[model samples]
Target: MKNLNPMEVELKLALAPAGPAALTQHPHLASYPARKQSLTNTYFDTPQGDLAKARIALRLRQVDGQVLQTVKTAGQGGGGLSQRQEWEWQVPDHELDLVALADLLPFQGQLSSVLHALAPQLSTDFTRRSWQLTDGLVNPGAIGQRSHIELVLDEGEIISGGYRTPIREAELELKDGDPEALWALALTLSEQVPLRPSDSSKASRGNALSNQHWPLPEAHSPAEWLHRATLALDAYHDSQQASFLSDAQQALATLADHPALDADARVYAQALPGGLDAHGQPSTAYGNAALALAHRLAYQTELR
Candidate 1:
């Protein structure tokens, strides 16, 4: 994408409301009532020589049950690699007041303001493009899978090169109206699957060491640390080199006591199996961060 024109820059700046309430109140938000949750996300532009126009984002969310979850994801194009950060707040359902919570939600004014600010900065037409996709298979209190597919255009035609990363995502929400139940589900899901490595780290995919660069803050939360460590472990395991399993297992064991990570991290660490991938790997774009996390947790049984 070319540098955004002055008008685009102005549009993006004009859209900034600086808070989640602003987005909730917007008229368009009414369509997202199920998303009664709220979050503040910040995106970054990668360095100029970057292979992909990587975007790093941090999200702080307040969910319907008053529980809070913070998540971060980074994507770099050329190497098909991405990083993720996640944390959760353990708010009890009894402590939440649904009515008061709704009252606290933002209205349309904020959304409009934010959009106005972002409009000018966008190289792509906001009105014409589909910004968010909500359609997906709802696993309801278990897991949710959503896939987003977009055609990359090159000179007015679809580009045929290998996808640095696959664009599909499957999420496991772990919700149950009770915080404990939510935690349980998160843990259970984590054990059944293997976390997929980022695209950049995979030799068959792309090189994360490519030109793209993002200024990342040191992850301090237990959940964030676990999430990132898991990604690194996935990369190491994918290499099929046996030197790192013991170290990775040790690192995973240390996270057993992390307060932010639900019980699932510990369960996964305990059950993980040790073995090489008997089947060949899939394309780089095969798994997204969330899917990778779930897979990692689930496939740990094979680690032993």
Candidate 2:
């Protein structure tokens, strides 16, 4: 697998404090034993953030006693699904091998210069408990086609300037199954735990800390917040039809009630009468933020 640049396709779900406990008790997960590990990742970039300028992330991760360096190239990610190009290498020690990275990056011959200017930026420290799941005998999906999935529960925080943002999240990666199976598992898990789709990656979030800015979606840009919010809303509706009406309304209300979103909600309110929900939920609020909001939230999410 290391011979190829894998397309990292996965979904991230933000969870409440009780999610890990509930998820551990899930029947499907309970059917198998879980593998647990603590991961400490240190991200690196040039002083002025050269790698980030091109949406590339370089990291060294220490798990147990082994060290591995990873380089990730940005790609489309939203609505809980992410697809990125990633290169990983096993190293004897905690260090970046610029010569190895040059073989993959489009840095011409300047890869060394890039590394010379790089330094540790920020870190994501978390405990990950993972289960190897299979679409088993009683599940509706075909067990033959939906072969395997890696269900990971992560709990910890992103630290910067001695401040920490708690992280309680889960990810379902299709290791040997139809990508669609990931959604099915997500839907099943959401029933037991409160979840919101995550649009940003851990690396991206850590980068934000280096800049001394907290990337609160609502606080920074309502328009972008609206876009990401709508994506999460759509996915949630797709996840469970039983609570669509109530949940969608609540999600819309969250956007409208936020001080940052209220003004934009009003401004875009009139032009989008057609987009309003039939249940009379504020369609203008979501429509305006979704259709017209700037992509600033994305920029901030990426940490450039």
Candidate 3:
């Protein structure tokens, strides 16, 4: 295991079936070398879901036959960008290493009592193809000065009981430099690939599958509306359910008239209807609009 920042800042994007090929062939990423890995990750929680109730995720991942334990707290901000506190360590096998975790968790005995009863609830098996991008090369005088990022495309499935949800997404993690650069890079790549900013993580998706419950987002403001619309778009793509598309249309309509919406953002929201109408069909225009919506939502600060 290598040293990593305790704070994890990353952007997750929902990808179309052809998104992988489009991104890999993009001019900015084509010349760079890439690496592939097979990962199996199992998530743990108490029988009563104590850890999930507390918005904590405990996972054991097998990478190249080496096992790693990771714990992540509930993060803030969605639609594209999120920040959370994470702790990871290497363990001998696929078991909880309480001794190592004891030094990292904030409350000792309170959580430890439940940790002892934890069991595997769900797992994700996937293949990841990744690339490392450095400053001054990809963006050439881009904003935020210099930036470093790890871009990965993940494909696989989330399995729990008899249900399995397919996984096709891309992630961009800030290795070093300005966080603003993430949105910039995503925007440039999204122009060619069909991408939608996502708030759903593998753990959340598995949990949702286990319980068979899909909830809708509540929106009161422009920023919240954007969040609702983007999540709806992704959900529609995943299930091809008409209700999700209706939800997206409603949210977009609200955002189109909201007083707080930026002039530039309103244009994206207005253009989304054409893409939404073409849902369940194949068209890059729909993806371009979805990506544009995500980009605008990521920069909204009114929620604060």
Local distance difference test values of all predictions, in order: 0.28, 0.62, 0.77
The C-alpha TM-scores of every prediction are 0.29, 0.70, 0.90
A best-first ranking of the candidates according to their lDDT comes to 3, 2, 1
Sequence-dependent TM-score of model 2 = 0.70
The full ranking of all candidates by TM-score, starting with the best, is 3, 2, 1
lDDT tens string, model 3, 192-250? Answer: 88777778778877776777665777999766887787777666655567898888888
lDDT of 2 at 70: 88
Show the lowest summed lDDT stretch of 10 residues, model 3.
275-284
Instruction: Superpose all Cα atoms of candidate 2 onto the true structure and report the RMSD in Å to 1 decimal.
Output: 10.3
Report the number of the highest-TM-score candidate: 3
Better of 1 and 2 by lDDT: 2
Between candidates 1 and 3, which one is better according to TM-score? 3
Q: If candidate 3 were superposed on the true structure by all CA atoms, what would the RMSD be?
A: 2.5
- Candidate 1 lDDT, 51-109, residue by residue in tens: 12222221222333343322223332111122232323343432322232222212122
